[model samples]
Target: MTMTTDMTNSTAPVKPGTLFGIPVGELGWFASLLMGTAVGFAAFFAATFVGIISIMAINTIGHHAIDYSLAYKRIGLPIGLLVIAVAYAYLATLWTKRILRKA
Candidate 1:
């Protein structure tokens, strides 16, 4: 026998997932980190592409002149870390407020 419970008319409020006993709620820090990773990856690829193109054009195909570290280390990593931190902080505050209001 198989039985399924319908959730359409349920009146209970769904609680968001938590982390470290703190209610991260929706758009949690981990999710933000994942998003930041995606953003950072995109940034790194775009920056590398542009830098490589610029070096090829300006340096007249100087095969050994391009520095790849600038894109991922200096730009992309920092941006990703910043986004992760900022998003986590912002979401924490926002969710805290929303939860408090509901309480």
Candidate 2:
């Protein structure tokens, strides 16, 4: 007599922390720090780009030309993006924890 068993399926789900397809926990502390910092900087630059475009649009619609008069206006975007990045990183980590709990 012979007995057969299937081992191809898992009874419990697996959860892994990921950001942009990179397993967050698998990367050691230094690598994770680098990845997070890169994400933060990219977010900041993207926000700056959007801000510039917004300012240009406002100036063009209001005065029919590009205007670069306010320095404070330019500063807001980077600050806002920094906040967003921090919140995003924090939330992402929290989310990872929640997902891991399901495993």
Candidate 3:
């Protein structure tokens, strides 16, 4: 068996990427909020679906009953809210600073 690997040069210069003439690091707060909202919305639906599946599996295999509302009210809501808040905060901090520096 022969093995090969690509080596990276530490001294090589790296370039920052840009979009629409704006650097990636300088994404705006509205963009951040939009991204967060999208993620949170997805998470909410995913969590709800998973939770319901788990509950159904339990009901079938263990003869245990779980309220479907628990998925949305407890598991899904908290996860979605947390994701949205964290994502928005992180992106806002990174993008908003560019504005302050310019002003």
Candidate 4:
């Protein structure tokens, strides 16, 4: 029986004009940074909105009011939004890599 190696360079070929090993196609770092940041902020706001709605719904079900002031003061929403934003930024950067790769 013939044995085959798993770590072969038989992967798909890479296109030209890639930055950071990502096929961004001559995209500058500054632009990509801004794009990533925008994506992060978008995710942050979207997640925050959904979280707030969910919190309000849950609190209402228990006959409790949503304490907006306490929520912000406790940094719950802020922390969660920050984490989601960072994750989105990372995904956006990864998506950018795929953008030019397909072109």
The local distance difference test score of each candidate is 0.61, 0.62, 0.78, 0.62
Candidate 3: stretches off by over 4 Å: 1-24
Q: List the residue pairs that clash in candidate 4.
A: none
Model 4 local distance difference test score: 0.62
lDDT string, candidate 3, 1-103, tens digits:
9999888766634444343444545666777677769889999999989988988898899988788899999989999999889867766766777777799
Q: Flag regions of model 1 displaced more than 4 Å.
A: 1-64
Please give the lDDT score at residue 61 for candidate 1: 53
Number of colliding residue pairs in model 4: 0
TM-score of each: 0.46, 0.54, 0.71, 0.47
lDDT of 1 at 99: 64
Largest lDDT belongs to which candidate?
3
Displacement of residue 36 (Cα, Å) in model 3 is 1.1
Give lDDT tens digits, candidate 1, residues 1-103: 9999876975655465555554546564566556546655666566657665665675565556556566566655666566656765666676677668779
Write candidate 4's Cα lDDT for 1-103 as tens digits. 9998788667666666454576545455566666556655666566656667777887989888877555443444566567657755665666577676768
lDDT of 1 at 48: 59
